[model samples]
Target: MTGATVRPVAIKLDDAMKARLKRLAEARQRTPHWLMREAITDYVEREEKREAFRQDALKAWEAYRSSGLHLSAAEADAWLEQLEQGHDIDPPPCHS
Candidate 1:
């Protein structure tokens, strides 16, 4: 076992918790280990997606700031109306 990966991990749970895990594993038609691994994988994927969205939002804000562009209230309303009318307005140069 010299070159093999052998690591011991310990988890502490009460009888009720063990029973719940067993039931969950059975319901999912998986072993307890598979259930735990899948749950962890899903949680990490969700967190990554959220972080990516947050980063994209930040980039949009940064581009808006650096462009030093501001539209009047009427102009903004017209722009939105154009969008609502299905006009294919391009994104800002920086965003593009």
Candidate 2:
């Protein structure tokens, strides 16, 4: 592997949890260290996406409040219903 700096992380796991991790690692044919690394990577990626989405939602809300530009619930529901039914439709327009 290229010289990628790796930091050591330690976690305190009770006996049962440690046993479970070991069993899962063996079942997956991976080392406990590899499993922990993968689990942490997946968790961080998922949480980062969630945080970004939350920030975008907050910004959209603030913009709507300041400019009063938005689609009514009925309009949004219609667009969403069409999309759910697999119809190709343009998004509803936002207006004051």
Candidate 3:
């Protein structure tokens, strides 16, 4: 955020929610504003990663459909197991 322009945005919360936020902020020794900002940032980052993963899955599915090439589940599992056992090896070749 260095040298980046920031603008203030306002949100309205119910009384009970505001009280809860205040208590949590006090317990954490941070301002309510900081807590809200952190929450929003964490939510956005998580959602972004989830969306990227979904897009990648869609792309992979499309590629598989177009080419009809893939490794069986067992083949993929074996490759993963090898890697988990500290073996450095290529993925199993894809096939119809």
The sequence of per-residue lDDT tens digits that candidate 2 reaches over residues 1-96 is 379997787899999999999999999999999999899889999999999999999999999999999998899999999999999999977899
Q: What is the lDDT of candidate 1?
A: 0.79
lDDT value for candidate 2?
A: 0.94
RMSD of 3: 0.8
Model 2 lDDT-worst window of ten: 1-10
Local distance difference test, candidate 3:
0.98
lDDT by residue (tens digit), candidate 1, 10-89? 77879998899999999989998787777777999999999999999999779778885555566667777888999978
Task: Sort by lDDT, best first.
Answer: 3, 2, 1
Candidate 2 segments exceeding 4 Å error: 1-3, 85-87
lDDT (Cα, 0-100) at 5 in candidate 3:
94
TM-score of predicted structure 2: 0.86
| 6: Cα error in model 1, Å | 8.9
RMSD of each: 5.9, 1.8, 0.8
Q: In candidate 1, how many Å is residue 89 off? A: 7.7
